[model samples]
Target: MRLRVDLLPHGQYPDVVLVIDVLRATTTAVTYLERGADALLLTATPEVALALRGGEDGSPYLLGGERGGLPIPGFDFGNSPVEATGQNFTGRTVVMNTTNGTGAAHTAAQTGKHIFLAALTNAHAAARRARATATEEIAIVCAGTDGQVGLEDVYAAGVLAEYLLAMGEFTVDDGARIALTVRRNSGNPLEALSSSGHGQHLGRLGLGEDVRFAAGLSTSTLVPALTLDGDPPEGTLRFTAG
Candidate 1:
């Protein structure tokens, strides 16, 4: 078994991929399942998310996502972890589209069979499950901000790398190493998160609690694993508890 970490660059596929967007998308998704969500379905665009489950027909689909750090016009929920609280997702599906996270997830689904959502909140569970399944290679993908590297995602990736290293022996790339270093240097993950560009953005939007929420490490025993349960072009990346 080989363990590797890297960003989800376009067209790069591995045996299995773990997607991270800790400053709230991936963290929020995991939180939903931790609460009671049956599954989450991610899409690259809002139109696709809306198309997957149309309204008024007794479907358990609820639209949720964000753009430019703001909730979509008609979304059932925004990209906030706090916003997901106290909602009833039992036997329902959350069809989501985000500025960066869902796009990375969609791209990862193009080639990988086992896709796992990773974040500081569910670090140990995610790494354990990912390391157990992947045989050839594992890519810890960070959903960067608009094609550029975001510090928060990289920091969360670093946490995943550390957990993966403790689980088994493997080779880590420079990207992984850099993230690991960040994790090592971080005295308090929340402090690191509070200073990141996205973290500050969320703070400005009155979502500072969310930034703290995303940085909560290993607080959850649940792992959100993405399974392909439908056909492509309009396929669903369904989340199941692992």
Candidate 2:
């Protein structure tokens, strides 16, 4: 199988794109939706996120987003998986815009035949999905920060690549090989992310807990995949009761 990994959201080309933004956005989105949020409304701009929160959908939606590791002004919550998972968002919708994650989701939707959201928190499930999709080529697209590669996303991609490669004998491309090699070189994802560029910045901004949460592996069964319209059909994925 040919597996590719892209470091940025733009200029994408792939058959199946697995969007990764480990230190918070993607992690938090998956966590929130898993916790019971009706659905996640993704937006790339802060203005759009805020505006949506007050429009008709706002009543059942909670505004959540961040800018440079800090919660946006007046938002109900910032992009933190730890905090997001704690709530019982039974029938609520999360209106979210982040520095990376959501945009990556949108970008992947443009070219991927089967797009998925992957992170250290759900690597095994993602690998399972990849194996089942029966696709010969897959792309792990990272929601890089400000056009530069992000350590958290890349590290998570590396983890996923390693897991998928270990699932069975499958041909991997140089990018997949490199990602697997990096995952091995990192020793431990949490420690590696702690020293990462964006990770360090998040720590400085008092989001160390969020970083730790995002660094965890298989902590959730909430496999957030992108499909036309909204989330996938019922029973397509099963999650633990929140």
Highest-scoring model, TM-score: 1
lDDT of 1 at 99: 92
Report lDDT (CA) for all predictions. Answer: 0.82, 0.75
Candidate 1 stretches with Cα past 4 Å from truth are: 230-235
Candidate 2 deviates by what RMSD? 4.2
lDDT of 1 by residue, 98-131 (tens): 8998888878888987888888899888888888
User: Model 2 over residues 69-174: C-alpha lDDT tens digits?
Assistant: 7888978999888888778888877777777777777777766777777778888887788767846677888888877987777778888877777787776666
Stretches of candidate 2 above 4 Å error? Answer: 10-14, 55-58, 230-242
- The residue pairs in collision within model 2 are none
What lDDT would candidate 1 get against the real structure? Answer: 0.82
TM-scores of the candidates are 0.93, 0.88
